[model samples]
Target chain A: MSASEIPVPQDPADALAAVVALRRLADQLEDAAVEQAMRAGWSWPQVAEALGVTRQAVHRKHAKRLIAAGVKLRRRSP
Target chain B: MSPIDAYLHTVIMEAATEARRQGSATIEAQHLLLAVAAQEGTAPQRVLASAGLDYQAVLAALDREFDHSLSAVGVSRAAFNLPRPSMPSKRPPDIGATGKLALERAFASAPRKKDLRPAHVLLGILQAEVGTVPRALALAGVDRADLLNRVRDAIAGDGVE
Candidate 1:
């Protein structure tokens, strides 16, 4: 979508609230997307690169939750 | 522990659970408000219910607020067809900034620590003029000022008992 086409809330409160809601949506999306990628046999490095974050950062964030979810994760990439 | 201390602990614990259920990384003011509304037979709960804000109502209002806020940016949550993510196995979410602010306001509302009651916590949450709780209350067609007055009255009546 073009910058001009993007909707911006007129009210400052509404705009701020949209930021909060978008952050929450992003977090939820990341969790779901990471899990889906891992379950599909994607390596940690691959997922990290895809997310434009460090492997350690991604692992620290999601490894435990993914493990508990019983999605067998691949070993660390060489 | 003092009665108020114990009550605050239970409410915080319930709020943590609410945070976890909502997949939030921290327990926010909204979660604390939900905890207050869910607590059975409390003066605060009664006060909230009087304004048609039971626990379920609060949850519904918050959900509506989330959707409404997203729509403001031209995004629809229904477009995301992914299944809900698994619950995080980490420790219960700690109290976030908004939650701490509410508690601070609650503590400050009383004349002294000894005067503090459960209703004071609700007062603190209601005192916030912005953020998720206030926005949700507004969108739900509830008069926040009226609710705040009711909570204050409840606290005052409890003091006389």
Candidate 2:
């Protein structure tokens, strides 16, 4: 998006908290989406298309699945 | 406690105490960053020290930051535009009359006037002799001259101002 496309924004402190929250949410969503996509036998390209992005972009963002597969980041408390 | 907030507070307090130690009359952003570097105990300190930005050098930089910020502002120090994340000051910002009065007496040992401007007296506290501020700045790879330059540019620079 263009720079002007961005809104002038909210109170910075409030905006910062919201940004942090949203970032946490984005991570959870991306993680779940990728895991489920992989489980459904979708290739990176297929998942990338479904998410409306290039395969390389999607892979680069999440390919570093560094854990031993048992650990996961916790979601925000409901 | 929220994990991040707790982490941030530890950072804030460390910066504040360092500011006090450096005898930096004010809690400027350089001190805060220096404090963060100090708390991180990151490799940056060693790197900076090798670059000639030892603790004393960094504090000297921060002092300059404070001075430049004062006049670089279109108005005055009171009318400065601080970067938002750079708030809550490393030190308690009770810059009112009582604070000023206390400062005068604190500096009574000097050969100066009875009244001191905010910069004049605050410098008194954060100088190399007292606070760990200089040390903290050095840890951040900055010295007094650089800190002063940052403060100057921050206040007088283009769009951000």
Candidate 3:
């Protein structure tokens, strides 16, 4: 949807809460998307680049969880 | 450790578990509230139950609040068809800002640390006026003021014992 088409909450409390909920939803989506990409053989650099972040940053954030989940991660870029 | 300290630690640990179960990275006030509701035989738990806010009911209320908040921005969580993400099990979630605030309020509710009780924690959470807990309770048709009074009464009754 266009920015102009986005709906705004009438109440400030509702608006603030929407921001919190949206951030949480975004975080959950990122975790699921990153896991899905890694499981599908995407490298750390590739996922990081797609997410507009540094490879080291992404790796630090998700490597342990992904490893624990047993996703076969690519060690390095080809 | 004192009994109150032990109890708070147990509650925080349980809140961390609840946070992880919901894929959260930090234990917030709502998680603490859920932990309080789940702790059977506690005055806080009894008070919550008397308000129709057992663990499951609280969970439902929280879920409804999430949906309602998202709807405020015209977004529907149902529109997303992604599977539930796997929980990160490497480390337990640390307490977040709201959780810390609730604990602080709980501690402040009693005149002294030696007077701390589980019901004080519930009072702390109930005292938040502009957060997920209040919003969820309101959406669930709960009277926040009445609940606060009930929690206060519970705490008072505990002091007599």
Write model 1 residue lDDT over A26-49, tens digit each, in one string.
999999999998988999999999
Give the CA lDDT, 0 to 100, for residue B119 in model 2: 27
Tens-digit lDDT track for model 1 on B129-161?
999999999999999999999988888788544
Q: What share of the true interface contacts does each candidate keep?
A: 0.82, 0.00, 0.73
C-alpha positional error of residue B98 in candidate 1 after TM-score superposition, expressed in Å: 0.9
User: What lDDT tens digits, residue by residue, belong to model 3 across residues B48-152?
Assistant: 999999999999999999999999999899998876667776598888999999999999989887888989999999999998999999999999999999999
Residue runs of model 3 more than 4 Å from their true location after superposition: none
Between candidates 2 and 3, the DockQ winner: 3
lDDT (Cα, tens digit) per residue for candidate 2, span A1-78: 676655433445334433433443344455566666555466777777888899778766555441223324232211
Compared with the true structure, all predictions reach lDDT values of 0.93, 0.43, 0.91
lDDT of 3 by residue, A35-77 (tens): 9999889999999999999999999878888898888999998
Candidate 2: CAPRI quality band: incorrect
Question: What TM-score, over all chains together, does every model reach?
Answer: 0.97, 0.26, 0.97
Cα displacement (angstroms), candidate 3, residue B39, comes to: 0.1
Instruction: Provide chain B TM-scores across all predictions.
Output: 0.97, 0.32, 0.96
* CAPRI accuracy category, model 1: high
The window of 10 residues in a row where model 1 chain B has the poorest summed lDDT is B152-161
